[model samples]
Target chain A: MLQVHQVSHSYGGSGWRKSKAAAGKVLDNVSFDLEPGCCLGLLGTSGAGKSTLGKIVLGLQKPASGQVTFEGFELYTKGRQGIRKVRRDLQAVFQDCYSAVNPLMTADHIIGEPLRNYERLSPAELKRRTGELLEQVGLAAEDGSKRPSQFSGGQLQRVNIARAIALKPKLIVLDEPISSLDMVHQTLILDLLSELKDSIGLSYLFITHDIQAVMTICDRVAVMDKGQIVYHTDSPSSLPSAEHEAVQRLVSAVLPQHPSLRTSWV
Target chain B: MTSTHTLEVRGLQVRVNDGGKSLPLLKAIDLTIEKGQVLGLVGESGSGKSITCSAILQLLNRRGLEVEGSVRLNGRQLTKLPNREIRMIRGREIGTIMQNPMNAFTPVYTVGSQFVETLRTHSKLSKMQARAQAAASLAEVGLSEPARVMKSYPHQLSGGMLQRVMIAISMCLQPALVIADEPTTALDSVNQLQVLRQLDKLRTEYGTSILLVSHDLGVIARMADTVAVMKAGEIVEHADVHDLFDRPQHDYTRMLLQARLRGRKDA
Candidate 1:
């Protein structure tokens, strides 16, 4: 499990000294918990500090204040070994599937990179595990030989998901993973995320601007606006009724006035 | 103004030749936008939606693209027009708002100067008049203190602001048609709604027909009077928004609708 506690971060100030000019706070006392097999959704539009928070949680950037604990061990406070251990458990898949993977690397190699870093697997075993990862994501085994450009955007994202789950990580930060995809493909990716979580008991920190995507996949939703969580709800259906003006704006923007698709053919 | 049909297309086809063989990118296509109506074109990437828009604007000609068919703007055949004449109609008569706000703007110049230049290209407006028009256009998009925005460079503005500016400038000329190719796709939800609202306002006030090309079904459902679903470079189905969503005729259209509305509106 992952727990982020009162993490605050800022960027862009005049000097390095403590009494220096005030900086723009990208994250202000943000906190969240990811249960072992549940999904926690963070919904924020542009400039809402979601990405900044993602970086802080990933240990790519240290928050100015507060802390992140993975499996009850302080994340950033720990030294090299602790960082490495946490890295193995915390995975991420970003929006740009094309850039998320190296164009030069083959599909299986891309997935195997994480395995190679985190585990001590022989060449043959690594190859087999890579193939299994591809299959788990509903891709063909032959796809392992193909390059990133050879595969479509959706396939590349599948490969990224394969890479994320390569080590069987405890938590995967899905950062707008399907935003670049087409609608049908978006559905497929969301389906895969749900399947992966339920089947393998994987935890997800779902980060997206899209309300529809969150509703389809996340168990609990947290609405972040201007670097703070304005609304948190376990019931996504109740989102439209939230009192906060920010939440209301997002809800109106998300919910359609009429039914878009019919459940039954009637 | 007497013509109910603002723009028309008939049997539009695009073919690209790589090496010796020609590949059909867009099959014979037909669509129309009536006066003050929003015609939403929805499709996946490479569904030739953007290509269709380019074909309307006659932009594919630059890529040595072989385009076959008739594209008429208010009864004037655009495909057969000479480059010089078509250039005249490109922006002023048939305005465009593409996805990327940054690419649409010139980096070196202030936004006001760019607006003035764009306005003067098709119209014989004086510099002073163009300046006033540019500021007015900005304000029309709900940007307060339009003068400050005009003076600022494109980089100074946020993506949402720049996109609004794009919407503003597109409508400044009061063109008969506006082909917005994913105009709000790059912006966030708040800005997306704002842009959508602005486009709706344009239909009410200016009566400018819009060819809205977006992958978002939600956007199409909200903005469009008619919706055309495209796949593999062909229009699989075209119908009124209600019919398109309620009773999709094509299998692909049905699947797309199902994909977006797969689960409960919220889990």
Candidate 2:
């Protein structure tokens, strides 16, 4: 459903001060493909350009080079209206849920905003759809009346998810959606994502530094290092050769076992 | 050296007043850390890990917060000390690295200026001396060019580099104890490892005791000598790192470990 070829992006431009001159490239010749109904997990450190890639795919940022196509249609060539329509088909769950939704708006308004924009629905239908969306995401109907601040981080994230899927987008870019959450809440969010994907037959572009999270949610995984895809594997069992020094270090860093591993050390 | 127990906590409790009623944030708790040892405090949000640390540092506001029990650092009672004495000990005797490095630093000033200011506040060092020490500390924390970094603003550096700068600033004081509250939570995996490795090195070289607070079990396993599992403002289990991992008696600890392991296996 998605294809990106030889994309590159840098932060600064010419005529800047000497110290800021030629700011290093954030993404270098990045390429990837995502099939329909499959999750493509992007794993990278903070500066590894994971978010940058997500932004490019979402058409939020213009890539310095390379082209992005969605089902053979040029994403950038279509301009604003086409891009907006495409965006309605491609949703995103951002990292910070608290800021993702407007604080002044109630959950009903927040979740209903996308539906209102993308589809023409009467007031009664809008309210009904908002309630249903909230319920779908495991939230109560009463929650739609409350503001963003009244909920916890996990709950806010659920609201964000509800809004993202309100339009029933074909693809969802989950950008470190569970990073700020605690263990139990993290699991809950992951489970919710899985359930939503299955029920809606939606594809996911999961971006996170969390190797474990990627392993759990992704059908395929790609490890990005220094703005390049260092390894790509079809499944957890098919992880790139551990003999590769970088991959070996990453594997070791993940800490595969628990209590027994701890006890054995003692 | 002093006794093995560099810091001791006994029945520590914290309560915050909300709507004219006291809402207990931390239940009675006990903990101890030996010199050069790393202790991990693990919990979900609102579990009171951060509250406990804030209580120890006397950073909690008295207007809405109440603290009970005893906290001793190097045989001195932290709770009993007056604010002046506590202020004297804060940055000089006990350093802290908070979760967000960007929030911790000032955007208006260069990193060097902030570092010198921090040094001058606790010591009688001149600007040049403080600058030199700050550069040295930055270099020690793995900054490629400390001199250049010193002149750069906080926004000029990446999140990982900013975090490293925070670590440098905290350790430059040469405190006996360091309280790192999710120090690498905002960092990516590589930067996270870099920060943790640097912290490990700090403990080794300076014999500085560390209290590492995080929700990630993998992080706790790699860095902690002792592990304390916290839930809803209380310590559910406390033991040596190996024991806590190998034979977690508490169900919550086991669950956390299981979740962490399941995550690893899935990866």
Candidate 3:
């Protein structure tokens, strides 16, 4: 479970000044909450400060104002100790799988790196656990030896997911997880994520620019614009009727799946 | 004999020289784009879609990759042309819009300088004339306050803005064909719509044939008149956009359409 209360942030000039009214605020009074075992789709256009909000939620950057609480512990108020206590329960999967991992390390080592950080495991135990994680993401045990360059974009993303789930985290902040992949791989990864969520009862903060993906996977949807939550809905099914400018723009931009459905375009 | 098609490619093949052995990157493939037609090339990653585009444009390095084919743009053979001649034809007769617009322009130079340079390179326009034309073209693409945009550097603009600038540069010359490789992949939905609308306008107004390469089926379904499905270096299926979407013949094509995430019906 997570809660974001009036989170705001700004870059430049005010780094140490602690100025409340910074010139350009990246986030402005953004607030939301995620329930246990629920997926919340954070939808926004580019430059809408979605990534800044994600970093704040992940505890990578403390917001200048407001608070982010995870598992009932205040992350920024208590400083590093607050996150360190619940670090095992929180994990993140970024968009670029290649940049997320080291090119020199093999898939096994990349997944095992997190396990080594938290717990003491022998070499044999690490390899065994890595293989299990790989299989959990629909990868073969033999793929453990392959490096990042050796795997395709989809396969590399799968390895990244394997690494994220290695700690059995309760929540994962997925930032544009399938944006870099093709439709086939996109569907495959989304299906895999759904399976994992149901199987492990995991929660997700799904941040993306894709409306279709949000509609397909999210239990609840929130539309962000200019660093604020403009629209919130209990289900994606009701997103079409939302009157918010941001939500309407997102909905209208979605191309029909088939040409027959695109009668108005021509 | 005069060919009515704006672009034609036949038996195109690309093989990378890996040490002593050769690895085939693209099989013998054929594609044609008539005047004002949009040809969509859809495929998975590493399926040789980019290689096919490079091979058509003769952009592949001859030393590392061997391209064998006949590529004709407006009846002028491209594959056999010398580097100098290919360079002349690239921007003048055929233009390219890549996926990442940031890489298309130099980081240090302002957007206006790059746009002016490209215009002058392809045409016999003076510095003042090219600058005026550049601003005009940028304005045509719906960039509000073109004067301000022309004064700013490429990094100062967003991806959508840069992409529109790329489009403006590519279309200003009225090239016979434009190769747009994943033009909207980097943009969000709202920006994606703007880019797509600009492209559609060019095809309708200027009669510019487009070779649209993308993995997004929805984009292809809306933009392309004909669709070519590529799989592992081969064109598995090529059909009218409607036919391809409604009745996909190839197993790979059907699998691709099925993989598309359909919006929730309740919405």
Candidate 4:
């Protein structure tokens, strides 16, 4: 489980300020929780500070105020030890697969790097596990032998997901993981993520500006606006009931229903 | 609206030289945009949505790509027109809004100057008259300081600002049909909403027809009256927006509509 408590961050001075410490705040007193095996969709428009929260949660950046804890370790407080613990428990899947991983590296090497660095494994075992991870993410076993460029955008995203889960972290922070993907692939990726969360017991802090996305994949949804959590719902079905103008706008913008819904969902 | 039909394409085809071999990129695509209507062209990458737009705008032929078939704008034959005559109509008759507004602009020229130049090309308007109209249009799109926007270079503005200006410029000429190729793709959700709303306003108030191409179904749903689903260089389905969403005839359309990566809720 992960907890973000009273975190706030900012940059840029009002005028001729001596330091960024005196700069304007971008994130203001934001807080949320990621329950075990739960996918929490963090929804917000651009510049709403959702990404800032992600960085803080990942221990990549220290917020000017508040703290993020993974399991029992205070990610920002445990210092190097806390950071290392978070690394062992937390992983991330980025939006753009083309830039997320090294293009020249074969999918095998890309997924194997985390295994090689985190655990002591023989080349044979590493190679075997890479193939398994690729397959687990719904890619062909042999596909791991090809470089990132040799794969389509959706396929490369699968590679990225494979790399994220190679270490079997407790939680994965997916930052618009399928934004660049086409519709069909987006459905496949979402289905894969849901299956993974159920089978592997992985928690997802899914961040995106999309409303329909949260309604489909997330157990709970948090809507942010202007650096604050404007609305939070336990069931995504309740999102339309939210009174915030931002949430209303997002809900209203959800696309018309599709024929696929006849067999699947509302 | 006497003319319900604004733009029509019949059996439009395109082929590109792939390593010295001519490969078909678009397979006789056909669609129409009615006056005051928005036609949504939905497809995954390499589905020939962009190629369709290029075929209409004549960007394909200029790049040495081969095109065939017919595109008509209010009975004007766009495909067979001479290059000079087609050039005159491409912008003045069928305006285009590209995905990236920043790259669409001239880096050195002020946006105001560009607007004036574009307006002058389409109509017999003096510099002062064009400037006034451009500023007014900018303000109409909720952009403040129209004068400053005109004076500022494209780089000086944000994506949202540049997009608003782009919309302003495209609408200023009051072109019959606007071909917007992923116009809101580069923008944030808030900006995307603003742009879509402004476009919707144009169709209602000015009766401008728009060819809206995007991978975002939410956008297409909101802005489009009709929808065309393209896959692998072919149209899989075409229907009214309501019909397409309610009863998509093709598997590809259903897949795209459901491809938002959502999961079933436990509750």
Which predicted model would earn the best DockQ? Answer: 3
| Model 2, span A168-200: residue lDDT tens | 998999999998887778888998999999999
Local distance difference test, per candidate?
0.85, 0.85, 0.89, 0.83
Each candidate's clash count: 0, 3, 0, 3
Give per-residue lDDT, candidate 4, residue A159: 91
* Candidate 1 C-alpha error for residue A192, in Å: 0.5
Candidate 3 per-residue lDDT, tens place, A51-115, comes to 99988888899899998999988898655778888888888989888899999999999999999
Off by over 4 Å in 1: A13-23, A78-81, A255-266, B1-4, B61-64
Per-residue lDDT tens digits of candidate 4, residues A44-156?
A: 88778888888888889889989788898888764467888668678899887899998888899999988988999988898899989988998888997899889989999
lDDT of 1: 0.85
Residue B92 in candidate 1, Cα distance off native in Å: 0.9
User: Clashing pairs in model 1?
Assistant: none
Reference-based TM-score of each model: 0.92, 0.93, 0.96, 0.87
lDDT of 4 by residue, B1-267 (tens): 233468988899888888899998999988888889899999888889998988888777546677888888887777777888987887788888888899999999999999899999889999899999999999998897998999999987878788788778777888899999998877766677778777876777788999999987777767778899999999999998889887889988777755542433322
Candidate 3 chain B: 10-residue stretch with minimal lDDT = B258-267
Top-lDDT structure, candidate number: 3
Summing lDDT over every window of 10 consecutive residues in candidate 4 chain B, give the lowest-scoring window: B258-267
Distance from true location, Cα of A20 in model 3, Å: 17
The TM-score of predicted model 2 comes to: 0.93
- Residue B186, model 3: lDDT of 85
* Fnat values, candidates in order: 0.51, 0.39, 0.77, 0.38
